[model samples]
Target: MSYPESLERYAALGVDTEQALQTLAKTPISLHCWQGDDVNGFEGSTGDSGGIAATGNYPGRARTPEELRSDMNKAGSLIPGAKRLNLHAIYADAPEIPDRTELTSEHFRPWIEWAKEQQFGLDFNPTCFGHPMAESGFTLSSADSRIRQYWIDHCIACRKIAADIGEELRNPVVTNIWIPDGYKDVPVDRAAPRQRLEESLDTVLAADVSKEWNIDAVESKLFGIGVESYTVGSHEFYLGYAVKNQICLCLDAGHFHPTESIAEKISSALQFVPSLLTHVSRGVRWDSDHVVLLDDPTKAIFEEIVRCDALDRTHIGLDFFDASINRIAAWVIGTRASQKSLLLALLEPTDELRKLEAEGDYTGRLALLEATKSLPWSEVWNEHCRRSGVPLDTDWMKDVRTYEKEVLSGRV
Candidate 1:
């Protein structure tokens, strides 16, 4: 589908407006703000984190549905144009095996109803069983049947929930599965775990398809388990499995190794699947869900956006966890920056660049960079906010200029 003419008007002002809008349209950005009470010692805590308790026992025991709706509405108002919201929580209290049968449409009905009323979509992620279960390390092929059953049941519940919601709303519910199940140390039978994982996924997808719901398998890099190498096996295994089973790959930008190029990775991943959904975070050492920013050129966040734009992906969810600044401000800034970077990337003539690559010309990339050098960030931001009907914030232009300078200097 072609971009709207309004986007073309922005492109005339020297922004890759058409590409930016297209990239943003493909991915409905959502933030992952699910920290359940254990903030101080949460394993994934980073500079960006925010949440209010969803459950507790005290004088004010339960939060009313109105309270929940208010919180969601507030988040929606903050973003102004966001179309989806992701909720993540760890099922900590259930020590016994999780009962998938207990999970019903009724359980999530209230939240789903609220989301529909508010005109936003819902997605969820359950913490890996290994995070709380393993004292040393947990493998998918672990001898502990309880852990395996826990994960299996969780997936089953998620699929059921997605199917139920889809039936209720008459549209597909996006269910994402990200397992921390990986090898910690060298073991006898690596292939067995891989086989088990494939089988498990196949079963899950089969069950999901039986219910007429869609399932997306998310392959990510692991952290905090003391084992350094967990990348190659998981991705390769999942990609192969997804291809065979017709599953979608959910790509997270922060999960790649430091040495890998984001642009190259996006291009390669898109070859396998037409589009990808990802969580955004900033970290050189660890997977911190920081707001997406071009502060570091080495990360190539901007270039990745450009690559994805050329491919015309389905949706780009701005997955971030924020605790420091006003969450609303963070969302606006992050979304604007992401859109800007994408627009700049689209300005590049891909066909010309391909020809240059075939002839071994580094100058094509440099030429694209130079073309984006004169882009007016302030004007672009102003025009976009006007078009989107969000209040314009001029102060952010300074950082935008700094980002542009860094990009032009090849510092990014």
Candidate 2:
């Protein structure tokens, strides 16, 4: 682990090292479960398999619920600090929920029990694609009334399940609704589909579940494999709906233009929306759902959250699936990057920077910002991993290699 000299260097800037560690320990990042199985849920699904396409097929993907959970256990051990599990409706490992429309809380009992053992907070998302119903490249916004109602029922049912799970765990579940609804060609009437989506959302959210147990959020998309021309749940639509309904709006990092600043949107949304749900993802050209890295955007995001004092109102979660590499490593890297970003943000001398800005001393603000880039951040991170009882170096890769050889390789 790093020495005490690194801590002293951070203190010279008026930042408290011990307090930053404690704050990082309490910040819970939701680890996405889809990475374990390449988004191939055990629902026996078909049809338009959503627009979410996980590329590359490295050997040894988890094939069962027990296997996936075991893999998560290994990844969780290496990723320190508080952690949560973000699940999809399709991941339910029960015989009862034979179809998406008939899903119930009972179907997720196994998951709830597993979460209890892992001591993880929970979050959920409704499966709006990968079924015969969504083949038309639309779900809730489909012109067909029957198609729209089926998805609406599924979404409403998912919220109930989320509420029950959150009630059991005593941690509110952020139930997000995202649909692959759009058209490939310029629509003769664009307003009709969005209008239909509006009514369906109103019906789905009609449930009176306690906000303490379940917080609802709506996710929007830019474009997908099939829906290249338009997406029904665009940012404008969901932003308006979330504000009007007094709910949270989910800002997925990959769900916008490549150059768009997701970090900048946090303060903008918090000004009107009750809360925010961030799906921390990295996009190259489109929503490829690449494994998240400690890039500039990721760093800027948490810094902005801290600067605006919106930690309590913000929910941080991972959203990526890359089948080409080791799945366990993907989880550990992304979750750790998020934790590291938060730690870096907490260690910032924000008061001094803001004080400079308030006095219109732009030179001082920029100078301090540049100097912060060379601080002893890695030393603090090394100590954090040491105290969290996780590996502080490349030792984690050895664990994944052993699991791949002894456990994952055994799967047929």
- In terms of lDDT, the best-performing candidate is 2
Q: Give the alpha carbon lDDT tens digit for every residue of 1-412 in model 2.
A: 3548878888888898998998899889999999999998888879897677889988878888888999999999899999999999989888555788888878888889989998999899999988999998888998899999999989988999899999999989999999989878777788999999999999999977778899999998888887888888999999999999989999999999999978989999999999999999998887888888898988988999998999999999999999999899999988888888888999899988999999999999999999999998989988899889999766888888898899888887
Top candidate, metric TM-score: 2
Q: Kindly report which residue pairs in candidate 1 clash with one another.
A: 26-314, 26-315, 27-315, 27-316, 29-317, 29-318, 49-323, 297-412
Any idea what lDDT model 1 has?
A: 0.51
lDDT on C-alpha atoms for all candidate structures:
0.51, 0.90
TM-scores across all candidates? 0.71, 0.98
Cα lDDT of model 1 by residue, 125-203, tens digit:
5444324443325433344767666566667767776676676767556677765555446556667666766666666
Q: For candidate 2, give the lDDT of residue 258.
A: 92
Residue 410's C-alpha lDDT in candidate 2? 81
Q: What clash count goes with each model?
A: 8, 0
